[model samples]
Target: MGNDGQSVGDRRGGLAYYELEFADDGAVARDTGLRAAVTAGQVDDVFVFCHGWNNGADSARRLYTTMVDLLADGLARHTPDKGARTAVTGVFWPSLLFPEDDPTTGRPASAPRPTGGELAAGLEPAFPGNKDNLARIGVLLDDKGGSDRLAEFHERAKKLLTTPNLDAGEDSGERAAAELPTETVITYYSGWSRVDGQAAPGLADPVEGLWEGAREVLRTLSYYEMKNRAGQVGRGGLGPFLSTLATPDGCRPREHLLGHSFGARLVAYALSGLADGLVDGASPVKSLFLIQGAFSHFSFNDVLPFDPGRGGALSCYRNRVDGPLLSTFSAHDRAAGWWYPLASMLKRQDASSQADLLYRWGAMGADGYQVDTASRVRLAEEGFPYGFTTGGFYRLDANSVISTLQSPFSGAHSDICHPEVAWAAMAAADLAGEHQRPAR
Candidate 1:
């Protein structure tokens, strides 16, 4: 609600402009020696941003520009001086992509590995109950390829959990398979920072060093901010950034967090860490805005050990047309045309694409043609306004988005920032009511 947009960063503890390319070992920022850099304003509000995979510093800058533009517009209507704050910080993690072979010059580096599509495929199976499929985890656990580590993991988990009681019936192969380790398994990415080929046998780290680095940075940043302020230090990203919300002249009093795709997964890890006391908890997050989430194994029916905190909040916005949880599906977006590829790998499901799964389910309605109707419905139901209900899933239409536009980041992944569509989706997610699944 604070004004002074233009003058916000000009004051003490002013906005810190940084462009850093993060790597497993550490990060390289445009402004070297942040320890020495000083701003004029007392930092008030903080917004910590996490970028998705395959993105460079420049791409993050562009995203920052879009967010700034939208924020400016929103501020013009509400705050007296156009709504500005003291500090805005961004964390840029490295996203290594396969080099591409250029057609024009026949350059080998121009030919990059199929990163986008791969990422989308990895994220698809996280959305269960799509296509009325009950538990789509079978796809990922299928291990049809015979040699994928994912398949092996599921197989092992199934064996450990479904061995039958001491006096139980014969060991039916069906029963062994049915006992998939969907529960009691937590995704572990430790030691992912080792060089790509160095990790060895089974596990290949996804988002490798990103999460670890984020944790270290958040801890360091928060400690630096609250050296003197009591009950202000934090460990998780959002919590640490919140510690910087006051004292700086241009700093505002409120903050917003926005995450997409694998970024959402990292956020979840941060939150989980906080709940488990692995991360410091001097301050807690106000809200979480998730976009195109790419988690594969989490289920709403199950109880998550996470704590909502005294003032924590959650909101999700998924694109019905998004191929996988990661990116678009069409030929134009060959790389991410399916639900986040990695999600599929992690969830251990098999679907040609997330869109195929949705089309098979009755959720899409007219939009079902090229849409992953079921996946979106699951995302909207379990994650959007809130978790899924017992009787049926929750459904949101265009109207729901309109109602929430006033406060959110104001955009949708499927629409790719199309103002009208983004606005509608936000409104739908913001609408209040227990929505039953619509008839197919």
Candidate 2:
């Protein structure tokens, strides 16, 4: 279902100036500029990005341009002595390419079509350019036809969840394969980060209200597909791309990864592959910043405890990272609270959070990190966000700090452009070492 066309999408408008995409076949479409940069050693620093669902190349451009603005602004404040230039790459994959495109005509047969403007309206809307999707949100909120459509989609996703081939895409890394549960399971990332004050996972119902269940269906399906694509992109394209750009000449620029939503999953899985030497001579990531991730919360936990060696990508990358993994979640993100559970439920039966501390299910951004034994710091505590003391893991409440930067009424999910979020990201990326860039 991936695109293998010779041409790539438009890359104009993004602040990074240019962008690159990966085909579903795991090949980077084109990277003349990026290749030149790497060959000439012009790209001294690397800052890579991955986008969430419902995003195309054009959309990714806008998303990264804005996100980079905040990140760059925050970097200026945090690291006054940046010392060198940076290359920001926006990674796109065939995760969203659910439909197979005709190789001859260069057109897909169809695109994702939801009854209610594809769900932009009912959930978070403050983010720019998604206003049209909200027109029928009122109808969905009022409890009418919307629920039925959403449920249908959820059923379809549930079926897809059971399909053995769902995550079986070629170029799927060992890290990706290792992350899957033997059977389906759903869990909350459960920690102090839970908004409902619940520690258990399965107790909470994902479809508690109207639109929640349906929205989750779409979200979960998209996430599963994208998560797989993330692995493929990492193994086939992004990883090699980084290796190329990261080629050492005079000095190696520090590397940082930042992802929003499923992009977070991509970044984590990519690092896992690189750490295991999956990519030929790839360097480790400095710091990881996961903003509202849609992947499993227990991704870092060892599920097969009896084996004593069974674990997922989190375990592989945890030790290799030079800086602490900074994970931030917002309670208001209906997608994580609802959709992530529904999606994970297909992998887990009964959608229960009850566990033996062996394998934790659910999204990291929603439930927080589930690895009980891992060293952790709660950013909500005093001197926390700024007190990132080098390594291990840290979880932050999105509403606590990210809210202050946006309009009071904006849904916390769509405000990634805020300077405060950027500030936190800077802290998470471990770029706060003598950086003095302003958040303005």
Clashes of each: 69, 19
Tens digits of per-residue lDDT, candidate 1, 99-144, equal: 2211122334334332423422332232122222212323332322
TM-score of each: 0.39, 0.62
After superposition, the stretches of candidate 2 with alpha carbons farther than 4 Å from their true spots are 1-18, 95-223, 247-251, 275-282, 303-309, 346-360, 373-385, 402-411, 434-440
Over 106-221, each residue of candidate 2 has an lDDT whose tens digit, in order, gives 33335332344434342222222324333443244334444454434334333333212212121122122124431211122211122222233323643333343343333444
Best by TM-score: 2
Alpha carbon deviation, residue 333, candidate 2 (Å): 1.2
Candidate 1 lDDT for residue 229: 15
RMSD (CA, Å), candidate 2 to true, equals: 11.2
What is the lDDT, from 0 to 100, of the residue 152 in candidate 1? 44
Please report how far candidate 1 places residue 354 from its true position, in Å: 11
Candidate 1: regions farther than 4 A off: 1-43, 80-82, 97-253, 273-284, 297-415, 420-440
